[model samples]
Target chain A: MSQLFQHLEPSDSHFEPDKDEVLNAIRWNADGLIPAIAQQYDSGEVLMMAWMNREALEKTLQSHRVCYWSRSRSTLWRKGESSGQVQKLKAMNLDCDGDTLLLQVDQEGPACHTGRRSCFYVRLEQNKAWVDQAPLIDPKTLYTNKP
Target chain B: MSQLFQHLEPSDSHFEPDKDEVLNAIRWNADGLIPAIAQQYDSGEVLMMAWMNREALEKTLQSHRVCYWSRSRSTLWRKGESSGQVQKLKAMNLDCDGDTLLLQVDQEGPACHTGRRSCFYVRLEQNKAWVDQAPLIDPKTLYTNKP
Candidate 1:
């Protein structure tokens, strides 16, 4: 992973950081995980937020695809591996605090398991109530006929 | 704080939640803080990310302004109170996992203390190096008088 991975090849803004060095800079939580926000590159829309461990981040950098640590399954979850809603990584950014991540990706299909374009379909209304904004796509249809 | 503050008052989308109920839903980290992502509502541009505790979240909801728990200062920090880079809260959302927050805000001026529109102005180049993509603003000018 020491080899340079050209994220923006053929461009003037080119620089390199060792893979291990980049990973070490992150201040992981007590759970050894960091929160990663996935945003649509072109639209600037926030698609979803997930958790990533060192292995997940390494895999994402290596594969050029979005990978997250599934706390439920305790496994490396590759985006769109099953649901066909893949996140093609465009670029990744670390916050100034180095405890969080921002992922700009070309997202395909819905980003939410509930079949919404974004996980933030619901918002707090004026009355302090939650209001559903985006339409939902049934997860059943999304997972139908697929193993 | 017990009374429902109309966030979207004089509108149709109005509802209310008890303060205790709202706080109880969040699963704060061991540090008694949760990660909060601030996104520009109209633009979908993520301006910055910060940490918020129960008090901060409550204050944001009650005041209709963004407040964060400053880890470095160990105090409740109100956005733009000093730098004039304020974040007006539009709405807030809790992820499905109840561990993180997505705050939709109307940001005024640069959100990054570094004077960038966002803290994520640096990108990982294909050469595996970090390249600055956004123009910098001097914090010295941003916080000139009255500390």
Candidate 2:
């Protein structure tokens, strides 16, 4: 794996993501994307999971905000930009395979578009039935003009 | 969003994932895969994140073992089967958009192949340096024999 390692070049962003040693350790998929999971910094509750391309990762490291690559939209999405549910990055970690990232974030507002505190609002019941573990706030309340 | 809800037919799964109502809500990617994050049941530490196809998710819910779809090998991976780092599913959750899964597990041994308790061992320091938050245990010590 070390043989495949390549370093990130310096970026103009305020944070020096290029200087971050493990940046080169990320093993991106053929699509040049990796899964990024966000967990609440204090509670350890997982807020949401999204995909990040190399640029998205770099921007996140520089901005200290969660940035995701919107596959459907093919654009860089700064979380909470439209919904006001911003996630401030507290820390980031790379999994063993270097294909996954765990981001500890200071979450503001609900992390779900459905108005849930965390995106994981449904659970499988013992009877194999799925039930809501949390209540949904009106989506309209989260999005100002709908992004 | 609840108005758009529907139910699933009964299945033989102990938890009745078919009865698990949110099955249809999941919006799997074009590849028919979703990212699943595993967290320690007691400590709240995120262990690792992996990809799970429909079959992998079904089997995991049925058998109570964490099963992942290995993109590299294109096979179903039963965690810790060879290394004895098995993850017993304690609870499972689906994100609001149904694109991701959160699993709470009772993990045995290290959850990372690198012989670390959690896969998130690397952290970015203030000076943009990557630091090891945990010590790595020799991989050979974890595996009885190469699987």
Candidate 3:
């Protein structure tokens, strides 16, 4: 049996996602969203967690730049749109149930809005949420508007 | 200036998270839920992503067994309760924004219900979701009940 689990169509080397397959592949939540996690391609370090809609997934797949849905703002959030910290999508994976997404990304800059390399800076150690890393750049410089 | 971000109370050597901090620290969504990602402590492989409520968080912190809120069943899901694959919590991190959670776990067995090592077996390569890893055990044997 071929190792290929689910193939859209024969593409010699390039990714050519079928539009219908893309939409039907995932099991979207009640709100038509799925939880997406960004992991560093080289380091395997999880950079951040966010939500994505079908449109965001399509945009990311097409442009190869990660985009997410800003639930609070009720709009599409292009990663690093204002801060220039764009993440280049290396690979994407869907969990078995298809309720989650894992994106291997080549992050341009710090992933956290707080200027940390990863958003997971608050380590639960010794009963305290210790700030594990210091800011790489001033957070003020990262965001243009209050997000 | 102290590097300590947010401290619950003093626990010299062990993690003693404050109950108040546990509940108040997180910015729960309108539905009072947060997205949680589980990663293997040693490999840094993201095993799975799930939802967590205040009660789930409290249970995980207190018991260190890693429980999730089952949105589908509308009940608490104890990791490996049905299957023998319990995850031991090594560490927990709250992102700077406190909206998401990262769980470093010592997974006892396959993290996926499909009996695969990780839920993220459906890799998007060449525009198709190829099953990178095969199931170590039969999935039918893993699930005792319809979940």
Q: Number of the top candidate by lDDT?
A: 3
Distance from true location, Cα of B17 in model 3, Å: 10
Tens-digit lDDT track of model 3 for A1-147 = 111223422222234444356457677877899889999999989999999998898888888999999988989999988888889999888776677899999998799776768887667643455555667777778888423
Per-residue CA lDDT of candidate 3, range B8-126, in tens?
Answer: 21222234445356447578878899898999999989999988998898788889999999888999999998887898899888776677889999997789876777877666643
- DockQ category of candidate 3: acceptable
DockQ of each: 0.32, 0.37, 0.29
- TM-score of chain A, all candidates: 0.82, 0.81, 0.81
Whole-model Cα lDDT per candidate? Answer: 0.72, 0.73, 0.77
Q: Model 2 chain B: which ten-residue window has the lowest total lDDT?
A: B6-15
lDDT of 2 by residue, B1-147 (tens): 332232221111133345434665677777888888999988899988888998888888888988999877899999877787789999898765567889999998778776667777556533564435443466667778434
Q: Estimate each model's TM-score.
A: 0.81, 0.81, 0.81
Give interface RMSD (Å), model 2.
8.4
- Looking at model 1, the pairs that clash are A5-B126, A6-B126, A7-B126, A8-B126, A15-B129, A16-B128, A16-B129, A17-B128, A126-B8, A127-B15
What value does the TM-score of chain B take for model 3?
0.81
Ranking of all candidate structures by their lDDT, best first: 3, 2, 1
Residues B1-147, candidate 1, lDDT per residue (tens digit)?
Answer: 111222211112223344355566667888899888999999888878899998898889889999999998999999988887889998888654456788999998888775667776446433464645443565567886333
